[model samples]
Target chain A: MRRHERHEMTEEARQELAAVDAAISGEAANGEHAPLQELVRALRGVRPQPSGEFLAALDARAARGFRRAGQEHARDSSRGGTARAGVARGATQKPRRRALLALPALGLAVAVVLLAILLPGTGGPGPQPRATNAPSKAVFGAAQAGPAVAPDRAALQPAPAPTAGPSAPGEQARQVERTSTLDVGVAPGNVQATAQRVFTLVNAFSGYVRQSNVNSGPSGQGGATFDVRLPSSNLAAAIASLSHLGHVRSENDTTNDVTEQVSSLQRSVGDQRAQRASLLRQLSQANDPQRAAALKAELNAVEARISQREGQLRALRTRVDYTRLALAVTPEVTAGASTGDLTPSAAAHDAGKILSAALAVLVIAAAAVLPIAAVAIAGWSAVSLTRRRLREQALDAS
Target chain B: MTLVAPRQLATPQQRLERLYAESREDLYAYLASLLGDRTLAEDVTALAFERAFRRRRLFNPRRGSERAWLFGIARNAALDELRRRGRSAALAGDLAAEESSREDHLEGVLRRTMVQVALGVLSARERELIALKFHAELSNPEIARVLGVSESNAGTMLHRAITKLRKACDAQA
Candidate 1:
């Protein structure tokens, strides 16, 4: 039927039908339409009812259904509790997983830092002496070349010894030039004595005091500064001895390898000498005075070049054989001294150093973690988006 | 069975059990009228009750009485079974056997057979309306809610359905 026509029955007609329906069901109705009432009566009388056996079966089935529903409710409640507990466990484990993932990165960073600290030739810029321990062709060649090339070079080479086996690259000794600075605090009365003791120790180690300066204040607070050079073999023992003279405030040690530099210098010296020898031979054979003079002057220039290279090589060898030590001795303040004696600038300097170190660590850690976090977030988003799209497609199919 | 308790406060399940006891016979009759097979009616009635019991938590007393809600479920169940069987024409074989097996008076049996045959002449929707009206005994407004239509529309449709059944019965006579 059309939408508008379905409900077109008048109120009066509806009331008549309702009355007929009431009469058919045995309720009080206006006494009209006897035949229509009879038909409704017959229809109502024939209404079907279930047999007794069917009713018994229905009751049994309904009871079972109720029992099943109750069991499902119990199971759901238990599952809910288990899910909550699992969520709690997962929350606690999340950070531990992050820590576990971070372990290798952290280890890598620590290894980089320790390598920078412990390896030679990887320190701040400073005056680097020659390295005595490394094998150098210059030192060996200088030993054969004699005193005319360099007066000090012969003393720097080791005595000739019998060989055991051909040296491998891995077994080659690194030519490291060691330098250190020490700051020590001593009793005001002991400052002069400490300087004398350091001087004596250097001399005993076949070392020499390069410079020494002592100053005393009007209140008898005195300090001394010493610049010394010591044989490399005695460097550690001298430093230990100096440390006992006072409370050692601070120390810094650095090493520089100069094996390649010495080798290059020796090669240059050899080339210059060959050039000088050729010039001298050309000068001796020249008959013309101008040509002879030119050859002689050129020979002079080559000889001077050779001498200059030999001098440089000699200096490098001496430096490689010795270690430099810069020591500062200051009057110590007693524990009972006034607070005014403390230096605020020094304390602030130390604090700044600590802050910078902490900042460096944070930057390194961030560099390691940020990339991994970004990749993980991107992967999770992609998977989630794909899952949502697939779910939408499945719903559309259904 | 005595389904009504005169004096007691009852839980929701208890209330549902009482409704089930009170309405099971009528609901079975409604299903039989709608589906036209005694066995199918019993099966559909049980399925409808099981569904009602499962979804009882969603029931609101203010919506309609338990009887209307149950009949609505039974109506859907009967239609689903009919659709599954691919037989929307009418009850034929089992209904004939049931009528022949009846020990009642011959006139009463003939009247029932005529009524069943008249019901077959109506469309499925018309037959459902007639069953809800006479067998389930739901009011116009309750039937409207169960069928998801306006009360006036439910009454009009039911009236038209009854007129069709009356015409079919007269022709058979």
Candidate 2:
């Protein structure tokens, strides 16, 4: 609606101005704008004129195309020129130089920022996204089997992620069931060698591979996985050694403490055993046939309880004695796998990693820049708006 | 089919020169009315042209016409001069006194005096509105562009100034 009013007013103003022009030139007139025409003619008569000398000088300057104005002003300024000359030079030169420098400056800033993000070993960490769905648990301390262990836990921590369970103070001899999963990659030919190395590595740690399914299929696109058990004390060392056999794609080592359960079962077995001994004694002391039969039945029941509790204790002990590892060895040709092991899936995975890295960098850069740019633009707009308002107010104030 | 020829474009300097030639007289008139001092108006006019020439390439035709752009610069310069002076355009009794003395035609002197009195009745902004409309020969939209105002507001202000001037002129007569 305001736009419509503006258009209407503009049309009226245009016609009024045309009528004023006609009135002044004595070509035509409009009846409605008689006063406006009279006023315009009076304004033209009262308008000021430049002296011939001033007009001639300005005309000559224009003929020269304003080219010599700068040189003349520069020379004048060197000789302590007029304030106008100095202002003119500053007005023209400063903004042009700034415009010329703007693009490279912005480009340099973005380049520096991207380099800070992308370059390795400049104290910037790689995008290490968590690539697993492991159960989230309390951040546990190191395997506190005691300070008597010899291997350097810190050095072994570089590969094969170790998920430690909390070991409270003075909780010694914990019956923990350790479990780990490892996804390792090897050269195609090394699948067999790497698998053999894995078994030998386990054996060296006094562990055994209980279930093995090693397949380098016809296309050689297959992998090997092992269900193995190692001594709880040697679990970390075994994982570290296994990781050295190939590119450790992913690894998770988790531990479960079942010491209290084991202790409860042991107590139950002891109680049952004592009950059995007492039942037999009562059986021997029985004077009547019915009494002897009842004592014998009680003895049998005690024996059954003892046997059940003992079986539970044994199974728990087996878990405490060894740690289970699920190790999957996928064929990795580019990492020295035989030519047959190369698969489009592997190449695509690599390409995906590169793409993900690029995307992460771009995201980080955008995250860093967009907010500042938005603030700058907003601030600039606010200042421009305020400045314009203030300039218009100057007219009112005058 | 008629053959069409590619139009040659003028260089920026050439264009600036053309605008200077066309608008210099009226621009000076507008500045003189706006400032009410001949010497200051001259200096401001020169300065405005210099600034326009320096910043000619900065002009975007899509935003406004060349004349509007030039007048906008002049308006800013004249306004700055006003702000610096911290007073209204010194349109005191002496300017009218001097004008009446310059003319020998008695009837012309009387008419100019009446017009001068009518103009003097306007406020500074109203006087600028009139100067932009008549002396600068700017259309209302051009006035709006120069003054950084909406077209409707410029039209309303122009109408009000014209009405006030008419009343003042009638009373003077």
Candidate 3:
């Protein structure tokens, strides 16, 4: 063999020798082998006989064993009587099923408690909706009077009266008029009184009513609105007096120059009337009947021009003589109502309370499930472990 | 000669004395080997007798003698005790004394030690195989019946185990 192969062979031989050596000094030497064999040989060498005391002890032990065997046989014969005794023992066992069954009941009770804690218990069923049988109210009635005239026709609606008295020096110094608005959470119940107050103030300053609305708001929240025309001369007094009705959220005053409009309309009206007079004069001097008829037609055209100019003058004068006061009246919310406690916040608080109650219910249900889940898991684990152990034991036996 | 009668009418104390005379040594020796402690051996011996006395009515004469049945019960009791305490080095001394009488003494001892170590290293199945073979001393056919394997397979496993033991001992040496 080559050097490496020879080395390998040597290692194998060494291993074989070691195995043989281990086999020679086996486990049997640790038991009764070497010593017992040596003792047997020594006893043969001495005289192949046991000592007197040793034999006597052995004989005595044998006799005692024989007597004991007899006793055991007798005991076996008496075992039939013991069967009756077992029946008596069975009667004394305690009733234990109640303790075992209480577990599920306990769990159910806990769940119920938790649900009670979580649920809002709104005390009783919510109130039933009451029936209402009121007749349907019309939103807007007809104007009630013809465009020309009627007995109940409004001469003038309410307006803001001027606040500035001639004796009040500060008001007298301020000639410019002003107007203001009131903002309320809900409109006030007295719409007519507010409108009348506005009209009286404007009238106090020699202003006239322009236009006003008595019923403005929806039925749920009562209020009204009005637009009054007051003289520019009385606008400042009207605004100051109207502010006394409620709080003014905003106010604004404007001055418009209608001097141009009035002068232009007046001049146009004068020119048209002059033309109509000239046409009528020309018609009297006509030589032919057809010429007179043509002159009459020219006079009618001039008369129409005069009427249009007069109407423009009237409208312009009406606007400048009376200023418009737009008034909005509403009920006051008081300091408490303005503190931001409406449906949204109330709903949010209710939602939070509802969520807390739901969480409580969930926690209780979880508590009820815990013990059962634990028992199931423990039993499963024990059974699985026992099965595994059985497999192991079978393998060991093999 | 007339055969002597059994002591059927003996008191509890007399019965206990008779039981002590017939079985004290054998029970102590077996229990000592099983528990690896003289004190535990004594206590277990007493307990086994008490249990046997209480459950004596269930004993059947057809299934081997009373002594063989009692030994079986004692074996079960010893195994139960071992399980309760968990497997520890305390039981090693008792288990080592079983096969300590053959010609291959040193080799057997080394193999046994290695087998114990191998038992710790094996999966539960392998450990159980080792326990049944040397500890329980069941024959190959009996082991095969218990394991649902053929007798030849059991024998092969036994051979393999012995080979492994020899190799382990050689390696240690």
Interface RMSD of each: 10.9, 6.0, 16.2
lDDT of 2 at A303: 86
In model 1, the runs with Cα more than 4 Å from the true position are A1-6, A28-31, A63-65, A68-398, B1-9, B89-93, B100-103
How high is the lDDT of residue B162 in model 2?
78
Q: Residue A330, candidate 1: how far off, in angstroms?
A: 38
Q: Which runs in model 2 stand beyond 4 Å of their true positions?
A: A1-18, A24-26, A30-36, A51-182, A186-190, A196-215, A218-221, A225-248, A251-327, A332-356, B1-8, B37-40, B84-87, B91-104
Best by DockQ: 2
lDDT of 3 by residue, B41-150 (tens): 44445445545555566766665445545554554455444454443323334444543443265754454555444333444433333334443334445445544455
CA-based DockQ, model 1? 0.15
Tell me how candidate 2 scores on lDDT.
0.68
How would you encode candidate 2's per-residue C-alpha lDDT over A1-398 as one tens digit per residue? 12224434556766765676576566645678777667776776677777677677667666665555655555646433454464356446756967765865596577657765666533322223233221111111111111122333343332332344223235455777778898877665556656665665676567899999998764358789999987765666566666655566788877688888989998998888888888888888889999999888888888888888898899888887777899998876554321223467756665666677667666666766777677767877997677566656666775
Error of 2 at B38 (Å): 4.2
Q: In model 3, what lDDT does residue B48 have?
A: 58
Write the candidate numbers in order of decreasing lDDT: 2, 1, 3
For A11-92, candidate 3 gives per-residue lDDT tens digits of: 4433433343333334233342343232222211211122344334433533443233223423444432432122112212
TM-score of each predicted structure versus truth: 0.42, 0.60, 0.27
Worst 10 residues of 2 chain A by lDDT: A135-144
- Top-lDDT candidate index: 2
The CAPRI classification for model 2 reads as acceptable
Model 1, residue A23: C-alpha shift (Å):
3.0
